[model samples]
Target: MKVVTTEIPATSAPPTLGVLLAGGLARRMGGGDKPMRSIGGRTILERVIARLSPQCSGLILNANGDPARFAAFGLQVVADDVPGFPGPLAGILAALDWTATNRPEIEWVLSAAGDCPFLPRDLVARLHEARARENAQLAVAASGDQSHPVIGLWRVDLREELRHALVVEDLRKIDRWTARYPLATVMWPTEPLDPFFNANTVEDIAEAERLAALDDAS
Candidate 1:
């Protein structure tokens, strides 16, 4: 475990890399990349990249098979080190590894699902405030009555703990690993827009379109 601290300006310096987890099997959506699904005349992944690119130092995509599909996005494509479709934790680990190796100056990684195109623009800022104020090793975002464990800022030093949890402890749930560290949750009001809204099912895509239309009207 290595810990490297660097100056990460809340408004300027790059503190972390934005890792988009897109490796899901997507059985719920008929086995295609959820991020590639269209919403409001643009792919959900494109929208997500647009929103996330400015939040962190750089971006990476965690997806399996034919990395070329995402190559057009111009990001490094990483796959899970652990075999079998374990879940987002595997993607988190891959992101952590990328951070530890390439971005040694940074100490954290910000993760979010590719389908969450409307994620808050101030996500990194809010998470940094929560992590610093609480002295937490991890800070996850929550909105309304929902807690998004996958949408979080993770300390790069905890990479080993996460690996152990996934491999030996058999901890498949994100909350389970987050519980072991000093963690904090940043709550966001759902008013105006629920920043964490995701396009999981067909109905969700339609609702996103409707929401986009309503947003434009205002």
Candidate 2:
């Protein structure tokens, strides 16, 4: 339960599985998968995958309800084991399950929300470094005043613990479940930019466009 700090450079490489949580109904955007929504002339999911793919050994989508919709993306799609669309935790569960059963060589599964197009380019590298430095089972990303639990690293061995939390404890909050085990959080400085900022709604999408423009300008 004690939190510590560590620094990870952008260049470090690590073995990881990148999993994007795209199962949300996106009621805020009128009931479609939010990742499929477009911004900056590309689907948000595409931008996310482009950013994460470089840092991970493999990638998959943790989605439910319908798998066929994401067929063109050409990534393994997994559903929640415990039904009723719990939250991102289910996605993490599916990622862990996939890594444990199919891709046993992967040591960690890096999770991020599908709508977060500005995800840190070094996300997996930093989280893995922090996890090693803290000797923790998981590591989360934080920026300035907020903690982004969805952006994290999950050890392959934590699958059983997560299954218990979802089925028996009924705990849905990601941080709450992470609290039961050792965790390390790496704070991303907000000076240059806030990497965890996400496009959650129409307004956020506009803001992302402005930010993207600024990024291109500079």
Candidate 3:
């Protein structure tokens, strides 16, 4: 796979719609939107938007309840069609459905967790490159030995199949769903900072600040 560090050329870019998955019921971090939590003096979602906006043709937020809370971000808020906060897969489904309807021209959707403030700048470019080279239906990001199923490229055309998995099969695990298809796992270096680091709890917020400094220096 080609190692990309931003500065992606238009020729190698994918026609992808970015979906920030903020639909999860953050049980580990109390109950509110985890992405709303501030790190490095900015909301996690804010940092995420800054990282992803340039890589995608468009961006959407998948969150339940009142959309007004995220109004400041100016992103289209898409609620899950599955109803009730099932999981991140529900958020991905909502995004895929929205993309199919609103962005008919786009063939791919790149899904990323909203609470992840340190997403790699080359996320979109690298995912598309690996997926195309491997002839895979899906592509996910990995760091260390752990695979982040949520941070991956999805096929817009598979929205129906995904809905079936979520609703009929009751499949909430991303790995289980992606396992049925050919997938490419792209790795990113962790020397400077793990690009996929996510703030999942109250304590993680402090760690994110330290990581933020490392990221800035790099």
Candidate 4:
């Protein structure tokens, strides 16, 4: 299905539901949720929420296991619809399904890694602008030459197709599926720090602390 890009003014982009993809195994960071890991005294997930909440009409957490662990955050936590810890694509599919069921009026959903604390403030606006400008069904964020497939805006209308890719076709790689669509890429500067920078290891957390200080100073 071709998604007609909404021509709303960039500043008034369509109401978007933000989904935090936190359903990772985190084996590299020693299992458990990496977003829960603290950076500069605040949990990564807390910082992620702070960055994305204002940019979205509503926000939900895509996580597995017990929802009560995220209770203090006061956000609705939805689990992946595709089982076996299929990865971020599964998380994205779950977010699309959730938005379709709960917020049917919203046609777009923006997803970001929960472990990414430095998400740009202009994330939603820029993605929408790029999608409209390119007339693409999907928009993914990029820094320099690297594209972040999971950090993207997805059309809610494409949820069924995504589910088919995940369940029937067993497609797990995000880029592989996104390759089939008319995808727009919005690039951001990596000078201060890549806005999509995520903490995948203990050392990365320390680096995030230093970067967080840099971000605060700037």
Better by lDDT, candidate 3 or 2: 3
The residue-level lDDT of candidate 3 at 40 comes to: 71
Whole-model lDDT, model 1: 0.84
Q: Rank the candidates by lDDT, best first.
A: 4, 3, 1, 2
What would the TM-score be for candidate 4 when compared with the true structure? 0.94
The residue pairs that clash in candidate 1, if any, are none
**Model 4 alpha-carbon miss at residue 85, Å:** 0.6
What's the TM-score of each model vs. the native?
A: 0.92, 0.91, 0.94, 0.94
Instruction: Report, for every candidate in turn, its global Cα lDDT versus the true structure.
Output: 0.84, 0.81, 0.88, 0.89
Using lDDT as the measure, the top candidate is 4
- Tell how far residue 88 is off in model 1, in angstroms: 0.4
Model 4: weakest 10-residue lDDT segment is: 1-10
Task: Using TM-score, rank the candidates from best to worst.
Answer: 4, 3, 1, 2
User: What lDDT does candidate 1 reach at residue 216?
Assistant: 43
Off by over 4 Å in 2: 1-13
lDDT computed for candidate 3: 0.88
Off by more than 4 A, model 1: 1-14, 215-218
lDDT, candidate 3, 1-218, per-residue tens: 11122422343677788999998888888889999988777788988988887788888899999999988888889998987678989999899889888989989999999999999888999999999899999999999989999999999999899999999999989999999999999999887788999888888988999998877677
Residue 66 alpha-carbon offset, candidate 3, angstroms: 0.2
Q: Cα deviation of 3 in candidate 3 (Å)? A: 28
Tens digit per residue, CA lDDT, model 4, 1-218: 11122223224889998999999989998899999998887888888887887788878899999999888887889999988999999999899889889899999999999999999989999999999999999999999899999899999999999999889999989999999999999999999788889999989988999999987676
